[model samples]
Target: MSTSSGFSFPGRWRATFHQRDLAVFQRVADRHWPGAEPVLPRLSRSANHGLLWFGAAAGMAALGSSARSRRAALRGIASLAVASAAINTVGKGAVRRERPIVDLVPVMRQLKRQPFTTSFPSGHAASAAAFATGVALESKGWGAVVAPVAAAVAASRVYTGVHYPSDVVAGAALGIGAAFALRGVVPTRGQLPPPGRPPADAPALTAGEDLVVVVNRESGSATAAAAVIRDALPLASTVECAPADLPGCLEKAARQGKALGVCGGDGTVNMAAAVAATHGVPLAVFPGGTLNHFAYDLGIETVHDTVTALTSGDAVRVDLGRFRPGPQGPEGADGYFLNAFSLGVYPELVRTRERWAPRIGGWPAGVLAAFEALRGSRPLTAEVQGRERPLWLLFVGNGLFRRVGPAPGRRHNLADGLLDVRAVHGGRTPGLRLLAAAIAGPLTRSPVHAAVRRRKVRLSGLTPGTPYAYDGEVASSGTELTIDKLPEALTVYCPMPA
Candidate 1:
């Protein structure tokens, strides 16, 4: 006892904590809760290698009707991955805590396969907490559902005598920390502002009177979004149709309805905008596509946003880009583009993706198309402003697009009345050139990249059968195409900022 006369206080404190931790572990091992033998042990076993959480993620992605649900599931998985990595590699090695002796614990409650790894912070607890926290951060209802499971998983570690209460607590803390850290880097979707919009005169839909919603069956827009519209606006007519029938349905809806709504991607929105404009009807957009560029830019990310607008009659006038002779009307260009018009390999990529999308899925087909478009495709040679040039990509946006946070492309003002044109000069490497153009955006004029705001651009000298794309729809524009803008040509319903 007299050997170390001047022992540090911190050292003594640590020793005391170790004793308390062991005492708590023994108590947990001695205690028995009825009905725990059948569930928690199996639950912990199922979560041994993050299988349960992955299964939960898959279920959410498959069954959840909204984009937020899908995003929540993805965020949960990401947080879990981060937490698992931290605890297994860093936390375990740092602490070097020995596993609690399970002598006093019942054989029935004990795990079938005892873990061999060091357990200072429980990996299962960490993953559970992280996933639940992540999901909760994105979607509260899902988080509420997942939180109980996470708590159960954490408690099970202590109940089965595999980990001390302190270990489970530490793991959960670390998991929550990891999830918050991720949030710090990327702001929550809810935090993003739905920007300023100049309101336009639009009729308030009384229980969706004279409102017709056209849902594209092939666009992969969420079915739940369509269902929400049907419920929110009981009197609204709903049409879920194939791509071949989309244009016809849209036209019919435009002719009959006082207002037209679309629940699809930018391409589908493009057709709806044209039809609505041609028929003199306001448009409501429900974001259901792979990328709802126009809807996102308009601050309409959910069915709720559109429903609120429809009920309130709040709206805005936005520009639509066009190829020459767009949706023939009083103020239109070849076909209208609500988001972007592109030339070069992008068209081929769209063509390929569309061709295979029915066989495979949308995202997978996109991946396959990207490989085909990049690997086997050649640069497009076209006449731009009377100068012949080889181009990797020629992009024209309906309005000036600006990048904000996670969105690589977004427009602050949809009625800017100018074409956002960007061209990537082609040489040895087309990919690099396109990347450069994308990064430079509307603020550069380098050797391989250039961007400008233009009233119109005359394009020609393309191969006779060369393809081009506008608003996600691919078409052959022969050897000539005129890129132009029709500013404030379309009126769309969007909720006015509070």
Candidate 2:
């Protein structure tokens, strides 16, 4: 399953040897530093996701009964090989930066017998990304989903002393480029159709004349939000409903001729914003979620104070998250996510946190939820924008941290067009790092942490039943996942501070 200085081990010994090597690594850690402790390697912690993806693909390959399917699988493998060579061999070598570990300890030899390769872009990361890309091209559904795993794996290499975080990033970029370039050469036998264009006969609205509010009862926002809505805009009509009913509500309101106001979680807001955009209406949001990431991004932290300004909130154009689920079975079930659509630890945390919310209320729930997640954590394959690599954790945002809030002092501006991504190579300490990052003051930024900001995120193969939630709602329960940003789509109640 793995090689130790060029000697292949039996599959059964892989696990045992891995443990032994890890033990050796720890001992090495101790020998190198007697009193002080070396920070935990994030890469090692996230490796399981890579192994999981490999197994899943191999299993899928095994299920091929027809010669055509077998041939397709073989071609996919070949594509992966080509991609690996391109990203890892060509791209990484071209970016010849030294690994952070080598920079830190130049005397230390690579743990394993690797080539005398340059370390600017991580080769392992590049290879994993290329492989994920190749897989995505062949089997869009699972392949697209597994891109996250590739990212996770790539990230782990950096965290584990094999490369620099930047190296992983470059490798991912290379992998994605290779995957896209190779798409013409690969066969996607089970590709899914795209989410079609919005129906031609959608709603219409006059921005200043009237307002329509679309709310999801499932968002579980505070009862106070409704009152805030009623007082905020007397002309704004409320349509407390689900996503499916959003378009209808918009259409009905358009007939009545109203603009829009959306007060709920990101999903609810996303639906409302979409309808508002379709109908040419200015939109307003009331902060309602536990995190209220969107609200924070928009610099509208308090709902009550900003209501009046929301009526005249700046109208800005933004992008949207789009997906055409790969060819797996049927057509026309493509979906999109507002805020984030994550796999691996993120979805698991959402599910676990929701289940425990009733028993452990408030911040306590978050604490318990994180504990549960850590107890059963694993690596994930992921692709962002187009970079292929495995990662332990990934968060994609509508805009970069700097862009989402007022950059002056502590505030961030939300209108800029970029996605903020964060991931940690597998490690024990990164958990603490994450906690610290979460609790840190507004002005603080953590560069030592793992993160990337891009336009899109695609992930797959963390679990057979990957439960992803968007804006805190369970969007789907399958392996494939895609997350894109809807930029400046919602003009929330964001007023310049007094």
Candidate 3:
């Protein structure tokens, strides 16, 4: 029976594999597993349409403290989607094996309503493994917490006599592979390094001496971040203050310390930068707030990141985005933006969110604000550069921001010395127009949205008391405005490549 492939008994080999798989399935069905009797069957049912994993993902996004956790949740869901698509369209049809017979299995272990689909591969097992693997790829701690549950879900497929041992194993392998494939296409944050600019000179403060850190009491994970700062940089002085007092605290610290360190969100970092630039001190950022965009973009996700840079004197000179008439509207007054400045419904959304955040919380406040701000808002009429235009939103970034997936773009080169400007065109439904702009991203030039890059931009014709937002803080726009970049204005501490 030897063929060109050198196979003697392909049919017999397959038969033997099936026999082993059936035997293992029968043993799992026949065994009197403790606690699994009431748990495994229901657990299997919960994962029928991938509801359980979706719920788990939502929980991670809602309850997890930091952006990394939210990213892990998103990655997990994406991986699950890939694995499910593969199972339905390719894997199942490739090998249309029948569901295993439950003749020897206990009645209680059997599913109430058996799956009618062909059962070559267990979709539940694939989804479980994929979600867990994707989450672990982003965050190891959350992965460890999820691995046991994913394994249990896979095992339940066999224990309940629906899938053969081989089916579950193959499904899990496919799921893990799907997660890695997704990562390959959309690289993780760790995969990309911060922008490099030939590393500027800074004082290597061993033990973080002469560094003063100001931590906002209301920032997310403030307590834990302060503890880490204390433990990692014991010699660094820390000032804990309310959100209202951050400006003064940061200014005083910038004047007193060799380097000013800040632990808060983008708004806090913006204030810190203004003071740091004025005082000519390097800045160390600890990401201790919700959506710490500035710190994350700078490659400083935690206290350890800043500590490493501090000990090594590794720093970079980054561009600062600035606008005229500052917060004061006085002559020669100006303000700086570390992340972005925006006009239109977005600033209104920020204003609403801030007003209600203390009452309901950040995430809920944002959702409420989105609805409240966009409910009946009309397009803002403004003069751009030298022309009049009606726009729903005009976004200005410190540097060119590249869209990662769909929205909230990231900057790879922070010192590119250009303003990333995106304007959503005025339309009947501003909400839809804004969404289209987000999806259309930085390259789009449509009736709904447009994007451009420049060294500076001038805007005018704003109605009196028209509000604008920069780095999550809202302010009234002056009659005329100038937005530009200060190239390499602020020295920031960041990790040097190993």
Candidate 4:
């Protein structure tokens, strides 16, 4: 049956699970619940929370009572109401699906109050997200809570068997679209203004250079980054390719001699850079990676905030790290790194965490990776000339690890003639101590993790293998690894020091 005609509750639920893995989500949501019946009630309570929130927001606006304040408040409310109605009505009517309880395995629930119609898309979930997002646009602090609450509300509909997973997802999109459309409801303060002129000196897109955006749709960070780039480069064609397609896209671009802008995580960046370098094209780095060590090294603050700077920033040369594996009965083995090259605990942590990054975000993945590394092994034998005996992990940065920001009197000197090198070989307890120290502040006085400036290095036993990373990509191999810096190889855009 067509989703528009509405399938049996069980059939629709099953289809949604098959198509979008709603069943998998149900398990994820269960982790945060007490297994209460009529999950919609719990969700409805969150919508009510929005109502109270709006009342407070309105009250605050009234206290000030300027034309600006009143206009902003009204716009915010209207955006909320319109988004809510669309999520609850138009979207549901268009894509009719049934609630799980209506046909699926029945969960005993005391039906205190039934929702007022067929349940294809979830009105509660839609309205909650709409209201929450509208509020968040006005106040980020409030949005932090509202966004989570909205997510919970959507999940609750599934738990209560009032809406299929597809319904909630569609409802969310509908509500967000409505909010975006209603953005012009207020004049200037509450609503965004029209785009101003670009910098008078902003360079035109070079002729014959088509724009290609490689995205790992699964990466949440990449989604936002892609949006920003598209908005900034309105005249350029936006091609959204999957992670696997990245190499192909780069190869195609290089064949055509076009400049490609990659909008994804570190792995994506590294892949794009490698392709660009091989083709000898100027590659622009947009920091969408979780750690963004390269971006940090290049001195960009936030992905969204860097558009103007990126569009108008200067292009300068920077070093690249290359790894050449020694002969282990192999004829050809050479890899390039853009950021840092490391082996030992750090590499193991990256490999362990890279697998889980899609499910949990980068930060959470990093934390988990740290936990796993703690449980796994002690330091391996890392040989470096200037360094002591065996080290846990050895890092060689290409000035891309610590770029300067735009703070007054601050500089992110990419041409500093030095690469940041770090070796981690301390015991588990020492490793944990070092992690804590990093959290505290700069490692100028830390002992467990050693930071050194180096130009070249060689390694033997603790070679590149299982727990190893070049840039953000992880791989397993057995060969003698050589690390060297290539100064001023590629050009990238970045804001000048304040």
Top model by lDDT, which number?
Answer: 3
Write candidate 2's Cα lDDT for 1-498 as tens digits: 222322133576655744554454334433554322232233333343244445645666665322223333444455555656675546644544433333232233234333356665555665567667666555555565667666666644643456545556766777666666665543233232211112122122323236566665545453456666666556567667665776687566645544456656666666665566666655566665445555544445455534645444433344455444622314544454445555546767777777888787756777787788877776665454456655556655544443211221111334455566665544555476556544442334455345556666666553455555556655444555555655555433344443
lDDT of 2 at 215: 61
Over 1-498, each residue of candidate 4 has an lDDT whose tens digit, in order, gives 223324544666656555564455445344445554545455555465356447645674555312233334554566668876665556656655544443332344313455657666666666666666665665555557557767876766666556667677877777676666665443223232211211222232432135445566644367766677776766545566777777787777655534556666667777777777667665655666555555545555454334544455444566666677622225465666766677777777877777887689666889999888877767676556634465565666664242111111111445555666766556647466556434433223356666766677776555545456776677665645667766665555455444
Name the 10 consecutive residues with the lowest summed lDDT in model 4: 402-411
Better of 1 and 3 by TM-score: 3
Kindly give the stretch of ten consecutive residues in candidate 2 with the minimal lDDT sum.
402-411
Candidate 4 lDDT:
0.57
TM-score of each: 0.86, 0.47, 0.91, 0.52
Clashing pairs in 4: 296-403, 297-400, 297-402, 297-403, 392-424, 392-425, 393-424, 404-412
* Per-candidate local distance difference test: 0.82, 0.52, 0.87, 0.57
**The candidate that achieves the highest TM-score relative to the unseen native structure:** 3
Q: By TM-score, rank the candidates, best first.
A: 3, 1, 4, 2
Better of 3 and 4 by lDDT: 3
Candidate 1 residues 1-498, lDDT tens each? 111212123576767776787777777777767778799998999898899999999999877756678879988998998898898779888776677776657888888789987777889899999999999998999999999999999999988888877889999999999999888766566665555466789999977999889998767655767877888889999899887899899999988888998988888888899898888789989888887878877878688889899898999998877687443322434587888888888999999998998899888999999889878877888899999999888888877776633435457688877888888888887777777776766857999998889989999887876777887877676667787877788899998766
State the local distance difference test value for candidate 1.
0.82
Give candidate 2 misplaced runs (Cα > 4 Å): 1-209, 215-222, 241-256, 302-306, 310-314, 322-338, 382-390, 402-411, 427-449, 458-464, 477-483, 486-493, 496-498
Could you tell me the lDDT of residue 381 within candidate 2?
A: 56
Predicted structure 4, TM vs. truth: 0.52
